[model samples]
Target: MDDQQVGAAAPLAPTERTDYAAADSRRLKIILAGEAAMLVAAVLVVFVLKIVTGTGAIAIFAAIVTINALIMTWHVRVITNRGQHQARQAPGGK
Candidate 1:
């Protein structure tokens, strides 16, 4: 194989891989935290301030919950992918 091809095929060192995974986990955590904060703020706006009422309020909450669910779904996929990558890099992995 050419040098470029060989380099492309090489796996990341354990430290680099760990650093990447750690960064990804941290980012996901930050995103989830932000989502939580936003949901709390929405609650305050809808219920405490009474800015929205009845169906409108319900719709707002539903939208926020749906967005949160989508983010959680993506988060799970990222975690699963990371686990699979780690397993593939382990000794005796096929």
Candidate 2:
């Protein structure tokens, strides 16, 4: 591919992640807590359903998938918010 083509495929510099761990400290902890709570809730729900219905392995697999989806959605939101936060802090964002 030509340089222009390659450049087009690359993420914009502003959205390119330099650090995954950087964000408002307090907010980051809150996000972590929320994510953890979600994980716990998902697992608890799956386990409870399995026990109540005797659904066995399928229920466990469903729980894993559900929990993974929840976590992934949360992660995407966190990243987007973090990027927006960073952008707002940037001089041009104002």
Candidate 3:
């Protein structure tokens, strides 16, 4: 086999792979939207709590928000891992 044949037979670099680009873009959009929605929900929850329970409730509300943020982060991690696994298994994927 010639050098040209060997080069042509080489696998594409991970960055050069396009099999999952579209799906990855969609997943990224979903994650971003989900995170934004979560933030909005947290703010609304805190606002409601304050309105009904006064400033003294802020600490509890903040704690709840923190827990929710942690959960959201975990969800993002799951989404990323699943995407990476799928990409690795796809034809011509990294």
Candidate 4:
């Protein structure tokens, strides 16, 4: 085989695989951190409201529902966008 064919058939280098793994890990960490931050902020808001307004269990329940809804919305949007992007990159996509 010619040099070009040989090079094209070569598997990814160890460093290239490592780089892809590291990037995926970093992205996962960042996403988790953002989610945690949102939950923490929601807890803090609920805590302060409970102390000041003396709102009961319903407020906490509402806060949990709101946070879950927001998270679900975010995930759905991300999934949709990723699907659209992949479709655009597929063969014969316009």
Candidate 5:
């Protein structure tokens, strides 16, 4: 065999563990779910406030919550992509 083949590293055992794509995927799912929950909470808050107090500013609050949700959704996607990219570029990322 050539030097390259002879010097190749052996594969890991069946019991070996590594943190990579699975962790990232889990984190992404959590982030997405959390954002969705927040959106639902915001909507609930708007309805509750409206029913309990009949406030005229309900629309404003709802608008704010929707804007917040949109912004946060964008932010989470950006962060998730950035983390994945950085992880890939990190030394021994796999």
Candidate 6:
């Protein structure tokens, strides 16, 4: 083929596309489920400890559970934000 025809017929470079909808949906569902499970377990444990011990023990257990919940929430938020930022910076993302 002529130089012009060869150049014109050259294949295009591969382009990247982010399907945010599917990925975001899946990630959100998983995060929600995990958070819910963690909260439920924490509540159950606190209740059990309260019943087995007393008011003072319940208070301590509740404080620990609250701290755990906060930590988990912060972790999830940080991870989610990082994923969103990366996706936005990716090629073809707006």
Residue by residue across 1-94, what tens digits does model 6's lDDT show? 5434543533322232245545665777787788778777877887887788766766766787787678768867876786666556554445
Better of 5 and 6 by TM-score: 6
11-78, model 3: which lDDT tens digit per residue? 44565445456666777778778777877887888788888878766787678678777877887787
True lDDT of residue 20, candidate 5: 49
Q: Show the colliding residue pairs in model 3.
A: none
TM match of model 2 to true structure: 0.43
Which regions of candidate 2 are displaced past 4 Å?
A: 1-23, 56-94
In the range 1-94, model 2's lDDT, one tens digit per residue, is 4445543434345543334335444556767777677767767877787788887747676767677677767776876787776665544554
Query: What's the true lDDT of residue 36 in model 6?
Result: 77
Q: Which of the two, 1 or 2, has more lDDT? A: 1
Candidate 5 error regions (>4 Å): 1-18, 87-94
What is the per-residue lDDT of model 1 for residues 1-94, given as tens digits with 9 covering 90 to 100? 4434544546657776678778777877887888788778877776743444445777766777788778778887887687677758644444
Q: Candidate 4 on 1-94: residue-level lDDT in tens?
A: 5434543534445565556556655665677677777777777777887788886746685868687668857865675565455445444434
Which regions of candidate 4 are displaced past 4 Å? Answer: 1-14, 56-58, 65-94
**Per-residue lDDT of model 5, residues 17-92, tens digit only:** 1354556667778777877787778778877888888886567676877787787778677767866665555545
Name the weakest run of 10 consecutive residues (lDDT summed) in model 1. Answer: 1-10
The better-scoring model by lDDT among 3 and 6 is: 3
Highest TM-score model number: 1
Candidate 6 residue runs with Cα over 4 Å from true position = 1-18, 90-94
